[model samples]
Target: MYVVKSPLPDADLKTVADALQGALVDLVDLALVAKQVHWNVVGPRFRSVHLQLDEVVASARTHSDTVAERASALGVSPDGRAATVAASSGISSVPAGWVKDSDAVGALADALGTVITRMRQRIASTAEPDPVSQDIFIAVTADLEKHHWMFQAENA
Candidate 1:
């Protein structure tokens, strides 16, 4: 059943794999939430918020791909399925109906904050086990933080 083998020892591989899988789930759900908000956002700031939501979507999608690929390269299968994401994602759920522009901004900021917290934990967990994976987490966290800052500032 082992096709691609990992260079890491079993213990280290397990640690890195867990971190990567958690990261993948978070990123995938982040994109979905941002897009949902983008579609439903209203109010005077709708145009700007809608466009900003797209930026978060783009970042999440791009990072999700990188995280999945990194997991594969390390011989860990990445599960980005909707079910998996729904079950494992650290992000909170977006509301079901039309979201006011300010509410949308607040929601996204909260979700980004959650994801960034988890990403920092992953970054720490993977540091000694797999520096490469840790590096990816670091970069991802940086990008997510930028989005978080922007969303937070929207309400300021």
Candidate 2:
């Protein structure tokens, strides 16, 4: 919308940007929440769960950067401010205080699953108007799905 001379129409770019921004916000939120779980998880599986949570946090941060960069490349400013992320992210609120390892795993898995579902929707939304943007979401989806599986495995 900001005078980007891309082959994709401004309208399409705007749509893709919106989807990317929303996902970016959620990814940022998820990353922080994952760190929260990592720092506070307790119980018999503490070490494994804590380490796995670090991996989740790392993945979320990396994916968020990719999504934000894509939005910027498309001429839309990526809204990653804490206020914007708090308001726009679709991830559920993380529990406060110490979290049980099993509970943390389940909660993180649920959050990843929610983002994965939204990513699939974003992918479909961009498919017709911007295949490149759709491809970006496609790659994101694969990574998120892999993470989701890894997180869920923690519960099993």
lDDT of each: 0.96, 0.87
Which clashing pairs does model 2 show? none
The candidate maximizing lDDT is 1
Query: How do the residues 1-156 of candidate 1 rate in per-residue lDDT, one tens digit apiece?
Result: 767899999999999999999999999999999999999999999999999999999999999999999999999999999999999998989889999999999999999999999999999899899999999999999999999999999999
**Residues forming the 10-long window of minimal summed lDDT in candidate 1:** 1-10
Q: Write the per-residue lDDT of candidate 2 for residues 1-156, one digit (tens) a residue.
A: 355455668788778878988889988998988998888999999999899889888888998998888887777888899999889888899878999989998998999998989999998898888888789888888987888898788778
Where in model 2 is the C-alpha error above 4 Å? 1-4
| Reference-based lDDT, residue 130, model 1 | 94
Q: Which regions of candidate 1 fall more than 4 Å away from where they truly are?
A: none
Residue 75 lDDT (model 2): 75
Question: What's the TM-score of each model vs. the native?
Answer: 0.98, 0.93
